[model samples]
Structure formats: structure tokens, C-alpha cells
Target: MDYLELAKTVGILTGISGGLALLMSIAQNTIGNYGEKEITINGEKKLIMDGGDTLLAGLIDNEVFLPSACGGKGTCGYCKCKVLSGGGQLLATETGLVTPEEAAEGIRLSCQLKVKEDIQIEIPQEYLDLKQWETVAYRIDDVTPTIKRVFLRLPEGEEINFKPGQYVQILAPEYQGNDEEVYRAYSIASSPSKKDEIELLIGYIPEGIATTYVHQHLKEGDTLNIIGPFGHFFYQDTDKPMIFVGSGTGIAPNLSILRYMQENDIQRPGIFLSAGRKIEDLPMKEEIDAIAADLPNIKMIWSVTGADPGTWDGPTEWVTDGLKKLVDDAKDSEAYLCGSPVTIEQIVDVLTEKGMTEDEIFYDKFQ
Candidate 1:
């Protein structure tokens, strides 16, 4: 009644347990596997990518770099795309960023929308042509106490053909205590004419991943990976006079536009108003002055908000104030502004009050 009966019972129990374990392993693999999915863009192009990633990330992996100021954090609301079908449902984060009409029209924040299955999306044709470039940090110079001018040289046979005011995303590799890779966008300060080289005016935010990496860890000749030529903020072709405004590192894009205008001999009259906390905080003044000297129709004005009226030679007011003094009629002019959201909003209100319509003003709001 003893040994043989006990061994038989033990063998049966062990067999059942091993079968259950094998079944569980099969279920995990099947349920968790999100295999390849198709992404049809603009009803014309189709991409086959691995599923289970966000739409923003999938698009980036496929070499389509969308404009995302917050680097897929869903805060910038810049990576908006239209999903005709198969995007699942609207997320609260997406709803907060897009309006009701936009949501109804299939507009969604790409960063918040996951691609679990086949999907159809519509993006601008320009985005289809975007490319990721491999570059090297050729040089770094301190433009201001908090700003560093980093120059990047593209690899052989590679060149970035971006508009003057467009921006590029720099990859922040794992370093020090930060173990995850991330990206941050910075406007290209160098002219588009300089195809092989791009410059970024990066402002160091306390403990910022990309900025801190550039400021402290990134050295000349270090390899850098960047995806570029994003954003709609750029010089528009119009015969109407132009007004350019910027603050801090916001001057990066404006400088690119100005250089393009000067190099190409675009004779359209332009007035650049740059503001900073103090005179010393305004970087690239010499470069701006030299560009303005060659372009007779271009005028440069510098303003410092936190400077003493008696000591500073430049205007002791906001750049918008300097803008008001320079132009009397804003009705016929187009205004381009770049700065923090608050600063852009204030300048926009000023421009509107001066008779410029909302559509006449184009701005890039730094998040």
C-alpha cells in the first residue's frame, strides 16, 4: 500500500505542473507578441514596421522625423498627425492638446497614440522626405554664460537641406547618472547654404539632459546622431516687409534666416529686434551686425530688459517695445517671433494691437 503508490502519485503531479508551466510560457509569448504591422501614410505610401511602439517613435524609426519640441513627452503638442483609421482611440493627453474639431477630424498627438495594429495616417509631404543624419561635434564655443554654440559636421556624402528657421533633434546618449537615451530639439543657427555643417545655440537648463550633455560632457570630435529639418517656422516668400524678434537662444533660427537673406541677396527690407536679460546675455551680436552691414535694407536693434538705462547703450526695454519704435504701421508687414511661449504670446498681442492680423504673424514657441 506504500512505496509504489506514493511514487505513482508524485509522478502524475510533477507531469501536470510541468505541462501547466509550458502552457503558461506559450500564452505569454503569444499574448505579448506584437509582430510587424503596416502603416499607410497619406493613402499613398505604406511602411512595414514592428508594432507595439508609439506612432511618433515608429515614424522616427522609419526616417520620418516629426516636429516634437518636448521629445515625445506629449507636452509640446507639436507632433500632431491625422489618423484616418486604426489608431484605436483618443487619449486624454491628446484631447488636451488638440481641439474638439481636430479630434473629430482624426487629428491625434503621435506621441500618445500607440501602433498596436495596422494603421493609416496622413502627414505633410515634407515630413516624408525628412532624414536622420550622423554627425560629429566639430566645435563648441560659449556664446553666453548659459548658451553654447555647438557646430556639427555631417558625415561624408551627407548634407542637411533644411529651411532657415527649422530645427534638429540631438540625441543625448546615456552618461553619468542618466542611463536612458533622449532627444532635444534646437534651432539650426547656421545657414542652410552651409550644407555639410549645422550649428546649434543651446541654452543650458539646470539638470536638462541634452543641454547638460552638450555643456559638460560633449567634446569636439565626439560622434553625434541627429534627426533634422523639422518645424514650420521659417522665412516665407513675400514681398511685404518683415519683422524678426527673438530672445535668448531663440535667436538661433532668426540668425539663420538673416544669414540666408544676406547670402542670397534677398532685398526685402527687414528689421530684427533681439532682447535679452542683460547686454552680455545677447549672443551673436557681432555676427548679426556684420550681416546687417552687408544688407542695406536689414536693420538690427538690441534691447535688454534687466539693464540700467544710463549704462546700457542699447534700448532699456523689451524687444517688443523696440519693435514699436522702429515701425509705425504693422498692417503691411509680416512678423516672425521665436521665444518662450509667454514671450511669444506677449509679442503676438503687441503685433495684433498694431494692426497686424493673426495670420500675418508666424512664431515658434519654445516650450
Candidate 2:
């Protein structure tokens, strides 16, 4: 058998298939342009955008931002908006993400819904005022072996307004061998009062596009595009006591909320637990300790799952265990959680079982 010859033929076919896919995409975006169509937003503002693109892309191109972590990919499901009319049927990619209620109420993933015909959609009025920033990468650091700590500087004399625990979408440009430009959302780690510069913690995720670009290609002083302050997951200004649970880079927004509490002299009782595989995986420890020191009401707990007992002195248990022990104020406290979907869901179950209502809990799950 001519095995070598067969291998060569298979390789040739694979290359041709990839090339054809790229060509199809170009044709779809350009030659397939459906001309211009009017998008009536909330029946208040109307935008004229060329068809053949996702409604998400059209809205973004027109400076209206929606919370999308996976760009126009149908995976994130963060781009859900109601289409009052003219939005086609839901795509297969969205079936797993949208709930039955959402599907019944005209909710659709904007990234999967094409701008065919004139579409009338419902968008939150606040989204109309969202801002985009062209900033300089002020500084970058390898905070951990896998995590890069970045500080993006807003323009001189300009400040961004964001609530604690909110996140921003960073535009990851095509770099090195990467061929696509996509935006990935990350929670802001720095205090909102800092204003001029926002800090982000990005953990390298093997071949993940955004993490690869941030870890391998981005450099200090480079220009970065930012769109945000998106997501409903944020600090709620209530008199209730608070419990914050986070893991890995999920700690970003939790720390932001803690810093806000310290800076603003918010003295409500608070319990913060940040979990990681090892002690080093937990970033910004000293700053968190400082915040705790300033606010007597704040109690800090570090949960390490895989750290050596001789080297680490903190609790060596899952966040759920730590949560069970420390959530004494559950019924009177609001809980903030951030982590992977499984972790967030597990913690939510614990919180609810511990007497915290769903209304008293907020979370940001990294999909």
C-alpha cells in the first residue's frame, strides 16, 4: 500500500477544505452583502446598517455595544436581545443556550440572527450610551505562571465610569499567526475610583484566542480597544451583608468590589473567599489583605485546593466548604460569585440552600 502517497493526498484535501471555508466567509461578508437595512432599536432610535452581517456586528459597528464575550460566535449567549419583528428563526447553535421562556418571548442571540430585512429589536436604553475607548497598554506583568496582569491606561485627563464587579470587553487583534480579531470580556480588577487605568487578570488557556494574544503577543505601550462596563453581575448597594466567592481570574471582579468597599468606606459586614489550585494562583493577595485591614467588617479567606500543606497555611478545601463555614449571614447577605459555569452553579446551589434567595445573589460565570 502506498501509505505515504495517501497521507499526502489527505493533507492536500484538508488544505483545500480550509481554503474554501475562508473564501466562503469572505464571499458571505462582501459579495453576499444584502445592501442596507434599517434597524429600529427599542422603537426609539433607528440605525441603517448593511445586511449580510449578524445583528450584533451591525449594532457594534454603529457604536452600540452588547455584552458579548465570544465576539459574533453563537456560543456565549450573552448577546441575547428581543427581536420584536423581522428576526428569523433561532439557529441550532443557540438552542442549548436560550431558555424556553426566552424563545417564547422573541429573545434571540443577536450574533446568530442576521440583519435580514428591516428588523425591529428591543435594546436596553443604557446600551445606547456605552462608550468605546482607545487606550494605551500602560503596563503588563506575569502575575503568575499562567496569568498576565495588565493595566490599561485611559486617555490623559479622561476616566472611565464603571461599577465595582463590572467587566469590560477587550479587543484582541489579529497577531502573529492568529487570523481573526475577536473581543473577550474580563472583569476589572482595579478599583473604579482609580479611574485612569483599569487592571485585568488574564490566565493563559492553551490555544484560546484571547488569552494567547494577551500572553504571547500583547506588549506594553501598544494601543488596545476596549468596550464595556457590561454585564448585570455587579455590586448591589444594599444594607445587607455580603459574601464574595471567586476562583482563578474570577477573583478580578471580587477584588474590585472589595476595593470599592474599602475606598468608599462601605462598612457592611463582608466575607471574601478566593479559591485557586495553589497559593500562587491567587493574585493580588497583599492588596486584598490591605483592604481587609482597612475595613474591620471585611473577613478574607483564601481557599487552596492543591497546594502543599507544608508551604501553604490557608484552608485546603473547596470554595463550597469555605462558603458553608463562613456564610453565617446568608439570609441577610447578598452573595457575589464568579468562576466557571460548574463552579458558579455549584456555589449557587449552596447559597440557595443556605437561605440566600436567588434575588440576593449575583454571579458572572465564565463559559
Candidate 2 root-mean-square deviation in Å: 6.9
RMSD of candidates 1 onward, in order: 3.8, 6.9
In the range 1-367, model 1's lDDT, one tens digit per residue, is: 6999999999999999999999999998777468988999999888887777898888878877788778789999989999999988899888779999999999999999888899999989988787887799999999889999999999998889999999988988999978877878899988999999999999999988888899989999999899878888898989888989987899989889888988898988878888888878999889789988988887888888888667687677787678767777889889989998888888888888888998889888887
Candidate 1 clashes between residue pairs 3 or more apart in a chain or in different chains: none
- Of candidate 1, the 10-residue stretch with the lowest lDDT total is 308-317
Q: Give the Cα error of residue 33 in candidate 2, in Å.
A: 3.7
Q: Per the 3 Å backbone cut-off, how many clashing residue pairs does candidate 2 have?
A: 0
Candidate 2 stretches with Cα past 4 Å from truth are 1-31
Candidate 2: tens digits of C-alpha lDDT, residues 217-300? 888999899987887888898989888888778889988988888888989887888878888888877867888898888788
